[model samples]
Target: MKLRFPTATIAAVTFFASLAAGMTSPVLAEETASPTIVTNLRATPMVPANAPVRFAPPAEVVQTLSVVPAELTAADDSVTDSTTDFSTLDAAVAAQSAAIDDEELNCLAVSIYFESKGEPLAGQLAVADVILNRTTSGRFPSSVCSVVKQPGQFSFVKGGRLPDIDTSRRAWKTAVAVARVATKDLWQSPAKNALYFHARHVSPNWGKARVASVGNHIFYR
Candidate 1:
């Protein structure tokens, strides 16, 4: 069978076909448009002017150190230092003779008693003078007890103590009298500036200035 269509119907059909093709062609062309490539590195995002920014607190900083007290440091320095003013032992002790008293006087008396009881009164006075000098001298201990008790320094000291002295003995009383007079400066020792002494029996060869000879002992500075 032959199919026939009117001209106006054919024209209408042609117009509808053209409209459909035009709409679909644009969509297909857009799908095949040039593509843009994205990179691994991205630019930093810009924050809006009014945006609230969040920030973590900076890491806490810590410091540790030990400090010493100034007073404690000073005390430590004083203990380790032994040096003092350089003054003549004779002049120093002579100026303060009364400092030797109380139990300290007894110590001086005992030292003189045991050391020079056999010698004359002058010898005992000289011994006491030597002890006082040593006390003032910075080279020896400052206290009378300390000077008398110093090891290997005095022949009378024994067992780190003075021997049992007989205070009742006349000799001891004489020694006490001598020590009192010497310390009180009532009588200046013949060995005025002497800080050392020894029995005449043996020479220490101290090679020092000889001050005086009293009884059996010779005194020197």
Candidate 2:
């Protein structure tokens, strides 16, 4: 134990010992090895299959909508106005006839006579007569009010507005009675199938076109 080693030999042994300790240490082993890399596959983005998509509308796309024709609407109006609940035009006229009186009938006859010996009493009645004549000729309304209020038929219609009648007037009462009689077909012999008429003084354009003449008036076919 007392023997001493050479100086060079001691130095070489010390260097080899330090190198072996460094190789066995955990810190040195970690610093000498290659670095590890990690990746997370779930962090990547993806599009859903049910996602909504945008697009421009077609230039010539076809569309559908509901509509009502004018003729169909008019037919509906006709059906509503002409309900078959009333038995006949005559029955309706008779029902309304009771509302008139003898005084009204005389006043109506006087007013009608002022126009002509056998003329209709009121303007409405005159129009009704014209319509009746047209009906018999197969060219006008068959009903009383329908004939009197025919579209564009009478000048007194005033833009197709029917005036509220003054039923309280003596002349109007007479006119109403006359209307009732005419509606009842009491004077059918006077203007049978006559569709045209004019005042006694003025010749009618329809005179030459006449089928007959009654009292001071001429009638047409």
Candidate 3:
């Protein structure tokens, strides 16, 4: 057998139960009724309303930058003395010119001996300079030996062989020394770019621009 409560009593009991739950758990009401708190996480700075506004293009600025001042000194005083010798410049330049070296040196020495054994050191260097210029011109073989032996170039070459150079001869020694000086470029050549030269006696009248005359040879470019 089942027993049932009266409808009026049930209604009253349900109403009282809800009231008791509210009293027991007031935190649920507070949580439901409270306003949601919004937080600002970004450190975004606020510009003051009275401050001057500045606009830097997006492409120009990635970060703040600062510059520091550099230390400076007074300009050096100009030279007032006039006693400096200017010709000494030329002398100094002449003193600085020296020789270049190896198989190249041997070839250069041979050319100097045959072409200018009697000529002074300057003349021998001038000869070597001409040969050097020829090599660089693209018209002749780039190597010193090939340039010397190029067809019909030098008169002393017979069947591609230079007459044996005698080391004992003073002229040969001078020629070797000059060749070394010329090869190393230890001394600057006054011949400059003269690619052709002939004995002083023979005026090839090649009508070429004559640049320098060293010893018995006249040089032309």
Candidate 4:
């Protein structure tokens, strides 16, 4: 049997079926109606997996970033003091506050006193520079005491021992100041980089390069 409904009834039935589907699933209807939400989600920017992450540092950390370290500033001040100009080497020696308590400094001052105390201030500083240079020359003992007491070196060292020094003499005081200047590198040495020096009276016959002849001694590099 063939059953045929009217055109208006078929239209009414189709409209009700669509309304029922809308009531059953309201989320699907909302998504279909508002497509801009989906567009926004798809349009969002994404970082690559290998991209570097960046963050704003705290205010205190940013403030400290440009500040210089205290130790480094002190080091710079020391360098400036070393290069300060004086009218003469005598002025430089006079400026030193020489306290001869340290054993190494005592050894250096004693050597200067015995070797060239009678010589001019420049001569005394030259002797100190020679001893200081020998400490770093890698060819000699690495300390002032060791270098001074090295066998067959300074004539004043008697069997690896230094002789008693008269500490009350003006010459001894001057030697102590000269040692301070040399150790601190406050003044440039006339006998720069000198490793060995001998009295001007004797020739050791050493085939070494001569650097300078300051007062009573001849300095060799």
Candidate 5:
């Protein structure tokens, strides 16, 4: 004989079977859930090898710049010292005729006579000419004292022996004015390159070696 089970009992059995199959299935477990990963993103600074970097403190930059000007100034002073020569009033008169005056001419003559009397006329004029040559040479000082005081230049100045001039004297004033005129090149044909000069009576080695002769003096180029 055949027996029939209750409908409610059959339905409950079917539901339990389905639940057990789902729990044991690998495909169902993978499809149901997954773990999520989170990542953090932040900004970073990059430095270049050759790029100019700024200093943290601005005062340091200013200090570096300040030292540069002093260095440049020192270099310029060195150049000036090397190139410039100090000339005398006599040299100025020889170089620039316009700067010379009667007073300066007389003073130069007197100075020459005091120093060297053998060639009074030529020596005086020649000394004056030398002073003029130094004026425009650019190697010498632009002013009178500067040129006269040039180191190791003139014998008279070797031991720091400078002529004492009474500035208040009429002769001194005249000499100064003449020196100015001679330095300015006011008069021409006074002397040329007369670096070395001597009297007409005495034939020094320089006398024969001169490029030109003017008045009682022989001059060299």
Candidate 6:
């Protein structure tokens, strides 16, 4: 079989095929026509995910740590560095005597001097304790002088007055110290809780519970 076409139609088909071959793609033409731009930037290194980070404390925060109040330091020192000693009864008596010049202290010393001067130191202090205990007890006057000078109590009291004493004697000094010791509760006497006492030479038949016996005197509660 033979195929035949007109000469004009053949010419038109040949012109369209030549035009399609001469055209370029739109995206390729744009890329080729644009100018190349170059920048002077450097690449930064990335930190590892497992790395540890450290930040320094601020200067003001470091300075504030050493600033403690002076009162707080002083309170701590007082508790740690105290030097007062109370090792023995005589030591305690010596310590307390420097502060014992009041009227009550004088009355207590005078009573101890006349009543128990011949007795041992412990016995003399016991006498002072009994007087002080009487002052606290509901049965007697509240004041130390009143308790010592009460009617019919001590043999040395004449007309509610204390007798003259030779203050120059060592016995009087010791009596004063013993009185101070008892008043300040610096020493515990063997005649604790005793409200009454008498010479052992005479038996009053007090029928009261006996508390202690020191030197020549016996004490009762």
TM-scores of all models?
Answer: 0.53, 0.39, 0.53, 0.63, 0.36, 0.61
Q: Which ten residues in a row are the worst by lDDT in model 2?
A: 104-113
Q: Find the 10 residues in a row with the least total lDDT in model 1.
A: 77-86
lDDT of each: 0.75, 0.51, 0.73, 0.90, 0.52, 0.84
Candidate 6 lDDT over 1-221, as tens digits, reads: 87899999999999988777666466677777664421222244568999999898899988898788787777563343234446776776665543346889989999999999978888999999999999989999999999989999998999999898888887888889889778767678889999999999999997999999999999999
Q: Which residue segments of model 2 deviate by more than 4 Å? A: 1-128, 207-216
Q: Tens digits of per-residue lDDT for model 4 on 107-163?
A: 999999999999999999999999999999999989999999999888989988989
TM-score between model 2 and native? 0.39
Scored against the true structure, residue 97 in model 6 reaches a CA lDDT of 47
Per-residue C-alpha lDDT of model 3 across residues 79-149, encoded as one tens digit per residue? 21122222432332243323333677778788988998876667778998899888888878998899898
Top lDDT hit: 4
- Which residue segments of model 5 deviate by more than 4 Å? 1-126, 138-147, 150-155, 168-170, 200-203, 207-216
Sort by lDDT, top down from the best = 4, 6, 1, 3, 5, 2
Candidate 6: which pairs clash? Answer: none
C-alpha RMSD values across all candidates: 18.3, 17.6, 16.9, 12.9, 14.5, 15.2
Q: Give residue 81's error in model 1 in angstroms.
A: 38
| Candidate 5 local lDDT, residue 131 | 63
Please say which candidate is ahead in TM-score: 4 or 6: 4
Error of 6 at 66 (Å): 14
Return the top candidate by TM-score.
4
RMSD of 2: 17.6
Ranking by TM-score: 4, 6, 3, 1, 2, 5
Candidate 6: count of backbone clashes, pairs at least 3 residues apart or interchain: 0
